[model samples]
Target: MTKTILITGSTDGIGKLAALKLAEAGHQVYVHGRNADKLTSVIAEVKAVATGAAVDNIGGFVADFSDLNAVRKMAAEVNEKLPKLDVLINNAGINTTASVMTKDGLDVRFVVNYLAPRELTNALLPLLKKSSEARIVNLSSAAQDPISYKAFVGQERLDDKDAYAQSKLALTMWSMDLADTVAADDINVIAVNPGSLLNTKMVDEAYGEYWASADKGANILTELAISDEFANDSGKYFDNDIKDGAHGDARGEFGQPHADALDKEAITELERQTQTVLQSLSA
Candidate 1:
């Protein structure tokens, strides 16, 4: 069907591998990267494997996720690049050892890992709404710690902040609530835990155990992106490409056991806080 797919952070690691695999699967892949040279080479790799299909249909957008302004610009570009986006993968994120803040004064890790994707998705929601069937895949991890913006603004935690993990938790919860809100519109949002340890730069430079090859890391991502099973399932978490109770989906649950992600009350409060932060950024 040559479905159109856009993946952030497609320059390297799991993201780039996902782009390549989707390109090979006959999907038009829009690859993004912060680096121009990396984006250029990734485009070539995608084209080479995209034979028998309209190779030039692939597209690229470059933006450093670290900067909020750059993120806003990227958001605008995405709205203009594709008219009807079939899938949007919020895969671009980073983890830092120390606390840093964006120009808008949000923690660097929180902004890049969560705020960046959130802002981008909201900016493109109109175009996404235009699609008869649209899916938004957000990358989440087990170590992610649930957080409250109420606990962190102004007094924002940065020093050796576990803010990276907390940011991810916030993102997963946000996806959950958003999924429910948009389900009626025929759009689905799902959060994914790619895998446990992979030999990606994140692990190589930081934790030292990202041993899973990019191919393996990318599978769950593409599966959820193209799979039809998502119609019955939205706002759920999948680990290592498995449905609940499959293989490694069983990570110790967080928050309330009954509903581990984010519930209505928490989501409402978080959304209010998020709006306040976003508005503060603009003001």
Candidate 2:
């Protein structure tokens, strides 16, 4: 059956590729981009590549995720447009060259990678509940670092790598907590480390090298979004780089999440800090 899917940061890279894959499969695909021009172009591109029957179902939304208010507005627009959403892929993230802090005085990485997706998912929860089954796929990474609350709040400075890693960990922690909170609703929430150093714009800008195709990430995302294998997998992390072997064994088949992601203490702290930040944003 065709599903209704929304993928954020989908103008390029794995997000865009995943959007194309879903659209081609005749799913109603909603792609988002920060730039209006680029979003329009991507919608056209997806339509161009989509099967003729699927072309009409492709759409786009524009939002600058760096701003929490913008994210809220975008969520409102999405709720207004889509009656029910089957899957939500939180794919927008950054290792920035611009200012590391947003206008609201939060770290850009934290806001875009964690806070925005958190808020968006909350805003759209009602719509998600309308579906018989719903999936939330959060993009995580292999580079997670312990989150420093001060750094997350923009009070302490951190290098790009430090900031990015911490933000991803924050996201993964929240994913687990959210999964538990919504389990009774029949919603599945999974965090994904979409293959370390895959050939994507973010990887090239940060590391200048890549180990695998962006499709490797996109493939897992597509699977998690719709495949039955993941139907019962909630509040778990899928480390795509470790297929079916030991953690940190980069050659292993990717399946389970890293050890840190499963830490009870870290997960609790992450939830506490995330709630604090969200409250501050709302206030």
Candidate 3:
């Protein structure tokens, strides 16, 4: 079956590779990027690899996740244009940036890696509910750290790596929370640590060296997106970093996330803090 799928940050890295492979597999893929030109070129590249009618069904959207308003705009466009969405791959993330803070006064890493996806996923719930079985794949990290309340609201600052880890943990926490919310509606939300130090631009910028191929991450994402193997797996964290002990195998197994992700009190506090931040964004 050809399912409609959307992959955020598909202009490069594992996200791009996943989009191309998914398109080649004949699924309707919607690619997104922060730059319009790059997004257009990526769409053509994705189409080049697509098979059958999927070539005509390829779509593209451009949004800078660092901006909450831009995320909202893109969500509105996606809701209006795409009838329904079967899979949503929240693959956009950053470990470093020129500026630590976005124009919204939030840490750039938290905004792009966590809050943007949270907002976009919520906005697209209507379309997701239309599917027989919808899947939400959140790109988590093996670097999860305990979130600091002071830093979450932009009251205190953190180093690049700290912010990134905290943001990924935040995402994992929310993924678990959201899974319970929509389980009855047939929406399965899963968090995955694609792989540690894959050969991607983000890795090159942050670590200056990578230990595995980006395809290792892309393969797991593709499987999670469309494979019935994971049809019933929700609120679970897939740890690709555990594959083959070190260098990583494309096929990963389900594993546990940080301890905080499983804490009822922590999840409740996270939800409260998240709502407070989001409400502040509107105010």
Candidate 4:
């Protein structure tokens, strides 16, 4: 059966590839990007690969994840337009930016990589709950560091690497917390490190080189989003960098994330700090 899937940042990188693959497989795919023109183009590209009824079921949304207000607005749009959402892939992230801080006194990396996805997922919970089996696949990274609340709130400035790492750890931590919080609702939340330094724009800009093909990442994401293998997997981290010893393929493997992600104290504090920041944003 074809499922309704929404993938953020689908105009580029592994997200774009995954969106195209899913569409070709006949799933209803909604692609999102920060730029309207790019989103429109990607929607057309994705539709070109679609089979069956999925050709006419393509959708698109434009939202700059650095701004919480924009994320909320996009979520509202998704809620209003879609009846039920089966899968949500939070794939938008930034490593380097011209401006390190947003106008709202939050670090751009943390806002786009962590906070925005959290807000979007929470806002779409009602629609997700409507599906028989809803899955939230968060794009996390292997390069994780301990989260600094001060840096997250824009009080302490960090270099690009520190900010990006901490933001990913924050995302992984929340994925676990959210999974437990919504377990009764049967919505599975899984955080995944979609292979480090894949040949994508982000990696090309950050490292000037990539160790693997972006398809390696896209393949795992497509599986995590729709394959029955992950139907019962929730609150777990999938490390695609780990090769299957038996098959020698870089694919999905359940693995431990940052040590902080496993700490109950850290998760609770992150939850508290996130709520404080969100409330401040709303005010």
**Candidate No. with top lDDT:** 3
Model 2 TM-score (2 dp): 0.93
Better of 1 and 2 by TM-score: 2
Per-residue CA lDDT of candidate 3, range 1-283, in tens?
Answer: 9999999989999999999999999999999999999999999999999998998999899999999999999999999999999999999988988999988789999999999999999999999999998999999999999999899999999999999999999999999999999999999999999999999999999989988899999999999999999999998999997866548554668999999999999999999999999999999
List the candidates' TM-scores in order: 0.88, 0.93, 0.98, 0.97
Best by TM-score: 3
| lDDT of each residue in 1-283, candidate 1, tens digit only | 5678889998888898899899988888999999988899999999889845648788899998878788899889888878778889999877754437665566777777777898888888888888777889998875566674643464656443377677777888788988888888888888887765665786565676543555656877888788776655677776653333323332322122114365678777777878887788778
lDDT per model vs. reference: 0.76, 0.86, 0.94, 0.93
lDDT (Cα, 0-100) at 42 in candidate 3: 94
Per-residue accuracy of model 4 over 9-90 as CA lDDT, tens digit each? 9999999999999999999999999999999999999999999899989999999998888999999999999999999999
| Model 3 misplacement above 4 A | none
Candidate 2: lDDT of 224? Answer: 89
Candidate 4: where is the Cα deviation over 4 Å?
A: 244-249
Rate residue 84 of model 2 by lDDT: 95
Ranking by TM-score: 3, 4, 2, 1
Instruction: Show the colliding residue pairs in model 3.
Output: none
How much lDDT does candidate 2 score? Answer: 0.86
